[model samples]
Target: MGAATTVAQNMSLCDKYTTALLKDNNATNQYTLMILLVNTAVIGNYTTTPAPKNAVPGILANGTFDGKAVNLLPYFDGSLLSSNRGGSSGVSVNFLDGGGAEPLKKNLPANDKNSHQYTLLTHLYEFFGVLLQCSEYNKNPAFPAYAGHDMESAHRFMDLSPSEVGYFIQQVGLSAASFGVSQEDVTAVGNSLNKLFGYRCSPPTVVVPEQGETLNSICQNEMCPLDEKARCDLYPNNGTVVEPARVNGTGNSTGNGTGMGMPNATASGTPGFSGAANRMGEGVISLLGALAFVVAL
Candidate 1:
């Protein structure tokens, strides 16, 4: 089976573990958000590998999150790779890192201004939108409150789920495999996420809220207090708070609030998400072309 399928299969186990973790009243909502955020980072890394040729030099190397550089591979033009070398002839796509340096560029464009095959940032944006939705749902007060406060509407920020997150990570792995990213590099990301969140890697036994834990209460007590720095570290412009609502058991709300199963609550129009998928598709096509070229040679 494909890696994506394998990961999807494993998602059930992850859900189970997560459910257990959240069952404890002491298990803060931040923990769940942290899992979501860290997973996004790992998955986004997979979607765009070796950093884009055109991306700002040393940007990924620096490992900084300035809202402009972190998780932004899909939006970059492949031509930038050639420009770094002075021209198309100067660029070379070489797999396998060695010589105490990064790999040679084999798939960069010939010019610095041409349209890129894929844009990684786009995927991140869409991913962030999904997260926002989740955040919003957690915070909505019209639902039962988790902590003492009304729901914060922050859960709506996340549009993607843990399973979908796993799928994206696997997709990135497939992309990186095309470029010859080392098994160590790919596995390192996965290990990092698992460690960061204490992830269980098992499917959840219960997808619904725990007993006495209203969705709104979970959002307020468990989810909202999570660190904004953690979210921003994964996707730029993420973690920003929207409006708040009440946690009255009825689920009526006002003003762009996010609730469970709400329309567009985690909709897929975020620029980053769409852009990443588009760029990855381009990379896949490019890889196929390269394979054909090698056969012709």
Candidate 2:
């Protein structure tokens, strides 16, 4: 793509997200709105349900959450190889004694922005109309339109039980919700994922606390992402609230409906998150800082 096209693609999708975000004047509320949307999806119970509260302990005990050790189940669909999903790009992990949950990555750059191959962030970004060229996405002429990039294909091999599908959505949804996505968007994403699973997890129940656990306490204690800085609150947010920008009109990218206004939420929250002051401002700084810090590895 030419420079102008690239710029337009970047800004067009960004406008969709920022337009969605700046709708809320208070930066914190923006984050809250995001979670509400996400909440509807992971636990939407649109099709399947319960997510087995008793199962969480076993998964946690097995050190399977947050890519601690590879489950090699839900990914590697379509043309994608094990490396595309797993830390397969020469990635090295160092585990402390009983530290499977927090294994340290030794990969130089787990994700490369300049590369055409869609790494994690890049692949996720395209969901919001970024139009990145993914080496693993739709490379084969025989691959389907969204092929390796689609959630259904990714999880198809797993043949996940309804509960496993619910758990998968919950984990991914909670990860995005932490950044400030809403339940509507989260549900949109979840609905899309559920379709891949034949609505097996429709009407899914989000992973709630066993008994004594509260929302705050469950996430505060149980969530595990690569970023240690991720927290229970609208994270990567500015310390103070800021006035919402007067963004107007709608944002459409790549001439497809698959732009920022996606049905269920997934990657629309990446607006201005690269630590660039020219974008969404300071709210994204800390999150980007954490991301950059990981890149330093």
Instruction: Give the candidate number with the greatest lDDT.
Output: 1
The TM-score between candidate 2 and the true structure equals 0.28
- For model 1, the superposed segments whose C-alpha errors exceed 4 Å read 1-156, 197-297
Query: Each candidate's TM vs. the true structure?
Result: 0.21, 0.28
What value does the lDDT take at residue 15 in candidate 1? Answer: 27
Per residue, candidate 2 scores C-alpha lDDT tens digits across 152-251 of 2222223223232233333334333333433333333343322322232222222111212211111111112112332224321211112112112322
RMSD of 2: 22.0
Per-residue C-alpha lDDT of model 1 across residues 114-226, encoded as one tens digit per residue: 21211122222222222222333344332222221111121222222233222233333333333332343334344333322212111112212432221121121122234
Q: Which stretches of candidate 2 lie over 4 Å from their true place?
A: 1-16, 20-121, 128-156, 187-193, 196-297
